[model samples]
Target chain A: MSDGLSILLSDVDVGPRRHPFLRVDHLQAAAGECVGIIGPNGAGKTTLLKLCCGLIRPNRGTVLLDDRPVGGWRGWRGWQGRRIGYIPQQTEYNSHLPFSLRDVVAMGRNALKPALRPLDGADFEAVDHWIAEMGLHDRRHQTFRSLSGGQQQKALIARAMVAAPRLVVLDEPAANLDTRSRWQLRDIMERLFRDRAMTVLLVSHDVEFLPGACERLLLLRRGRIETDGPRDEVLASPSAADVLAEI
Target chain B: MMDAYFIPILIAGAFAGLSIGLLSVFIVGMRMPFIGSCISHAAMVGAVYASLFQVNPTLGALVLSILAAAGVAFIHPHRRHFDANTGQAILLAFMMGLVFLAVALEEGSRTEMLGLLWGSILFADWGTVVVTGGLAVLLVAFVIAFEKELKAVLFSRSLAAVTSAATEPVYLAFLCFCGLILAVNLKAVGGLLIFSLLVCPAAAAYQVCRGYRSVLLAATGFGAMATTLGFLGSYVFNLPTGACTVIVGTLIFGACSLVRRALAISE
Candidate 1:
């Protein structure tokens, strides 16, 4: 409702046959807020994330980013890539690709730069900083597919944050991570939210991986929001308990 | 010893090999190797139709192959409803049938038509050499100019789009490049065998290399080597040039696989 919200989805409908696979009447995330969206399988969580990232357009209604309609922005991809970092689900990665972890992370900067130009000193510095921040300095030169699941996740997170975007969107970031890696990811998310004041929209199936910095919770079921409120209140609600039970 | 006549043939063969080899890295990386075969067959249909109509077969092949690429690109937007491989397969069968019909309907010497099916690189003219060489240069420039975007798309189109690269246009351009390369190489490698040249060298390089840049360099080297050796073998044994080239490429891939296995065991 507020004009200053970072992301706003209003009366959105998406999917085949106009079937309304994801119908969110209204959702708003203010700047620097961390929101966690949790739901069971086939609940449109990933689709919502894709829509937010401009990877998919809503079949109907409007998605506004930084108070601007996403569909109206000329060269929106350039805008989105520079300002809105997106970490897609691990399943979206192709293991057969020949990119090393450093190469993968460097793509964050490459996305913003012109196609023909090589990475400059600033780009290299940013890539190195994130690689070290993610504790992947030792594995930076290794092929991405050769890394363990947790290591790969860390690399992906580093890639998403390397550009230092104002907003970051992650889809199931902790899906296959080990407990220690999940905790590390939690710390990273907290640091991004608290230190940098980066707005984050995180989608997850497991509530256990939700970072402590998440101030808002959204529970989706069968393409509709089942609960949306303050994180602690939603977690204490019976509806949230039922949703987690079904998962 | 290579003579004046063999000079044009060798140059054409090498250039065609390099162009197709560079494009093959993208085709193989995107996991659409079958689409290459389909595009070559579409070129065959165009070549045969041109022979029947008395038009320039190379130009005709370029048009048809581009059309086929466009068809594939068009069908991609509806990928959930229609699989791209299925569309390519359909296009391949349709083109094969059309090629046969065109050949059957032709009143002139069908040797030319047959030549398109099984290339005669040894008989290549200087013009063919020049065109193929030009294409080879253009392809290298293209790779250099769009290396980052190409790598992102090859890794994953969806992820590439999310990262803000315009994947659809890049994908369509890639498909068009594949078609154009197939069309130009029709004289040197033949429609039936060009796809093997496109796939084998890149596949061999993929087995041996861990980085994309290395893969591109290794595939180009393998391709040029296979093509030159195949041309020499064809001259020595009086074998089909196109078939010999494909055989050599496949053998290289096999050798690379063996080397990879040996290295893995040693590690």
Candidate 2:
């Protein structure tokens, strides 16, 4: 755990009923660190990410952002939307809904007050910036459901980023993406990491796509971190490989 | 003469058709037809209670319906296992109260309570036309103004929240509105038949359309058609117009189902 870190998990235990899915004794990602969480399929990486965003609460221990305990604030949803942007592994759109790409991206701004205060020129400029940044400027008006898997993923990322949160968490952002799209996503994420002051916490089973720019690595096995250190050290560890085998 | 009373009755029937028809689309899309039916039946009890107490039946029904709607909405998100059972219990309590009050009232008490128990389009008047018209217009306007928000919430509650939309207040207002409309229209359709009006057309529309906007429009059309056709049938065959209206609605639903199947098989 780095002293300058903005996020910390202290003995966070999440489980189903009597079985603990994952346990985080102590883990931290420094301010503006591009952290990657890699582990076996059932190692609870997703659960850990969810806990950080306050989407799910741990049975014990505390999750802290910038050293402030997440649940310590009573209004967690408001806090989450404002500071943390989360992109889930998979999104299932209700076929009945008709939402455009712009609509989807705009959802990232849910934390903003809705008292007849319309999105003005500055907001439109921000939306356009994200649209072009993700290379979805032309597809902004298309219905989200009509897009391909890779395109949808890009749009989802754009949606999350448009909120301009301090921390962005993405779970397997390249899972179903084509080779070319995956590379493009990696490049986009790298650019965002380098240019924007956005701290990224990415969880991926695919080792090939872990961005070269990642600042730290945490590998989980059976709900506990197997290796936690600088990216190369953790990725090269035997225990981390064992965690990968199970993933 | 048919000219004197028939026109007003026909107009009332049309109003009934439009209000329930439009609302049913929301019910079907949200998968809450049973909830709607339960509210309608509970509202009937409120109407009877109002009539028995010598107060405005509309006011009584509104209060009761709002309370019932709130109870269900609050419990629905928190307690799925007990929601249906609890709703049934509420319906039963209100029904029993209505029946008991009816029995205890004076034999000659001239509130014409039975009229509400089994409503008639034949009883439709200028007042019924006005109230139903106002409600129908409001329902259509609200649905259009908040279409995206409505679809978001109806499709998936968590998904809706994840989106930029502020879904809590909209969801609350939706439940309350459902109860309010059911209470208001109880005077036209009665408690028993209200469920049919609220569900049949929308269910039929779901069979025909994948697009939500189309589904709502189709459901509204189905409802209006049923009311008009039902009124004509009742007039010609001398059957109860309300019952006939429900019968027509069911037939329309059946026809739509058959058409959907035929299209599927051909494709």
Q: Which candidate has the highest lDDT of all?
A: 1
The DockQ-derived docking category for candidate 1 is acceptable
The alpha-carbon deviation from the true structure for residue A132 of candidate 2, after best TM-score superposition, in angstroms, is 4.5
lDDT of 2 by residue, B69-158 (tens): 776665533224254545656665666576557646736654456666667676678887887788788888877766656665665454
* Clashing residue pairs for model 2: A5-A30, A6-A66, A40-A247, A41-A247, A107-B164
Q: TM-score of every model? A: 0.91, 0.71
Worst 10 residues of 1 chain A by lDDT: A72-81
Q: What is the DockQ of candidate 1?
A: 0.47
User: Lowest summed lDDT over 10 consecutive residues: which window, candidate 2 chain B?
Assistant: B76-85
**Model 2 lDDT at residue A107:** 59
In model 2, state the lDDT of residue B32: 57
**For model 1 chain B, where is the 10-residue window of minimal lDDT?**
B74-83
lDDT of 2 by residue, A1-247 (tens): 3222278888878865467888888987777788888987888888787777665567898887776666533634445334566677654334344456776666565545352344556776777788888888988877666678888788878867776767888899899888999998888888777776667889998877888777688888878888888988887888876777776
lDDT of 1 by residue, B106-207 (tens): 887899999999988966789888888998888898888777778877776667766654556767888898899899889779998898998998999989
Best by TM-score: 1
